[model samples]
Target: MAADGLDEIDYGILHLLQQNARSTTPVDMAEQLPVTDTTIRNRIDRLEEEGVIEGYVPIVNYEKAGFPIRLQFSCTAPTKKRHQVAGQALELPHVVKVDEMLSARENVQVLAVAKTTEEVNEITAGLDDLPLTIERESLLREERRRPFGHFGQHVVDD
Candidate 1:
């Protein structure tokens, strides 16, 4: 839905950052892209302004950062009330994020982080009596996303 000449450059930057988000700096990217530093800065600014690039978030080793186990709940709420229930479910303090996905090929899941089993239960408890039905509750001890370095190793690495 969005168009930009610098899309590939943006993707290249993101690809490099996927392995280590802090790996490259703007100046380095400017040099690598062979574009003026101002151009690089302006491109990043434009991406941010359009919300194409959200705020940079550090991927804390949540497991190492005191939350060893995480809970992911797959929910199936009534079609009409999905929005309302999703709002309430995500409002719980321990609830980190809630995703409402559609389509037959897709799956719905809620990821919650907790320091202990009690915290996980507390989060789940808060979801009780919601419009959604709990289809599955999967607990993952260690989880990670396969880094999608689309541009591969050509991008600079820190």
Candidate 2:
């Protein structure tokens, strides 16, 4: 394991889980990795205890689910209020993710889904009510999407 407690095997397990969290069992992982089922289970348990593997979630295709419009908003707020503003954004409906950015121009990023332009405007209006200045807004046009693979690759290389 590295100084932070996660080693190459741990990363590989994480990657396999990320690719298919619901059905990828430790036994299945052991077949592909150089570890036994008991080792896989032990590593996963340790990783969970260390909070490296927070939780499992299903990846949803919002566009296919009728939420076609993807709105991205970048807001600027004081460093002290960044977390507060991000929290407020998280409470907004349809918000998928809210992050605090460290850059000067933009300090908060909000990603939300909407079914129509009016819904997008409504979401924007709500964000405007927060104690932050909206710096930029864009409608995302996703051209490609895939599962995360870098973590597994890094582990193998290490």
Candidate 2 segments whose C-alpha is farther than 4 A from its true place: 143-158
The TM-score of candidate 2 is 0.87
Clashing pairs in 2: none
Expressed as tens digits, the lDDT of each residue in 1-158 for candidate 2 is 67876778888898888777899899888887788989999989888888988988777789999999998888898888888888988999889989888876698999899998899889988998889899899998883656677666554322
Counting only residues 3 or more apart in sequence or on different chains, how many pairs clash (N, Cα, C under 3 Å) in candidate 1? Answer: 1
Which window of ten consecutive residues has the lowest lDDT sum in model 1?
149-158
The window of 10 residues in a row where model 2 has the poorest summed lDDT is 149-158
Positional deviation of 86 in candidate 2, in angstroms? 0.7
Best by TM-score: 2
TM-score of model 1 relative to the true fold? 0.78
Per residue, candidate 1 scores C-alpha lDDT tens digits across 54-139 of 88887667778777777888888776667676778788777777887773221346778899778877877777666666778888
